[model samples]
Target: MFERFTEEARRVVVGAGRESAELRHGHIGTEHLLLAILAETEDPAARVLIEAGLDRAAAREAVRRLLGEGDDARALAAIGVDLDAVREAVESVFGAGALDAPSKEEPRRRGWFRSEGRAGRSPFTARGKKVLELSLRESLRLKSGHIAVGHLLLGLLREGDGLGARVIADHGLDFAAVRRAVEVTTG
Candidate 1:
């Protein structure tokens, strides 16, 4: 699953895992991934949340609540989320093969270490590649050097309307604000 991420995106996952482990006193899970996506300082995802009114304190509170911790433990516990569900959610959000199985049109390819005949700059993982593609699109649109975290955030914001975007919007963040913030930061 980790194999499907770009270097930076992989790092984001790793960082999220570490955070989740710290949160649960166990191992990684989807909650962690969601938190990681929300916490990704260098990625645009984080920026989008920020622009949308997901203040750091509020985000932390939401994460804590989602994890069934803090003073609202009973309320969170009542929601009831098992490890498997957590794992599946993580996979779904991260595109780590939890759901949305890859199709034959884009068969799963081997990574640099596994591929026997490749000798070029290793390609990004599926998630990373997607993020990069989004970044590139943003870059081309904005005409800038490489991709920035803000561009990545804009990309995620633009991704087919889904939970992530819904969550962001719930907090009052609009795509335009996110794009403006990215442009300002990049500029």
Candidate 2:
């Protein structure tokens, strides 16, 4: 499948992996794929999204907020528990790196000779894999021999239930409108 990806499409996949690593995520989700496309300024998908008011920074923030805080945070906030304030207070007493330490989920390295856990490597999540598969389907549907950024966008939309879609919708950009823009730009 990767063999059929255009250079720009390949770059987006690579960028997604980089994004997942940067975020310390174990897997590359649909949100990371969207970030990759947005990070590539030269990509047509990025241009369309930017023109529609969904730039990289805005999208990134949305994804991070959603993933970082999650449902637990929302429930806590509703009950008047301020997680940020708690973190701040804890850090104030325990020093700057106190509250910002690595999560317990992260594997700890053991022994001098033992190699560190592959924290920097992130595999694609199920939804991410689906998106790539859907990208190929989209390329075939469009009668294109190579997968492109537009196809990737179509894949994300087709996946339908990812943070990427949520972020786009939250920003007031309709999915159909984004699909139209991608088609227009690629065509």
Cα miss at 172, model 1 (Å)? 1.7
lDDT of 2 at 112: 18
Q: What is the per-residue lDDT of model 1 for residues 9-86, given as tens digits with 9 covering 90 to 100?
A: 555545544554334423343334345556665565566565556744565556554444423334555788455466
TM-score of each: 0.45, 0.72
lDDT of each: 0.51, 0.80
Model 2 stretches with alpha carbons more than 4 Å out: 69-119
Weakest ten-residue segment in model 1 by summed lDDT: 115-124
Model 2 RMSD in angstroms: 7.8
lDDT string, candidate 2, 30-94, tens digits? 99999999987887777988888888899988987888644556678899998668867888898
Off by over 4 Å in 1: 1-13, 16-34, 37-48, 56-132
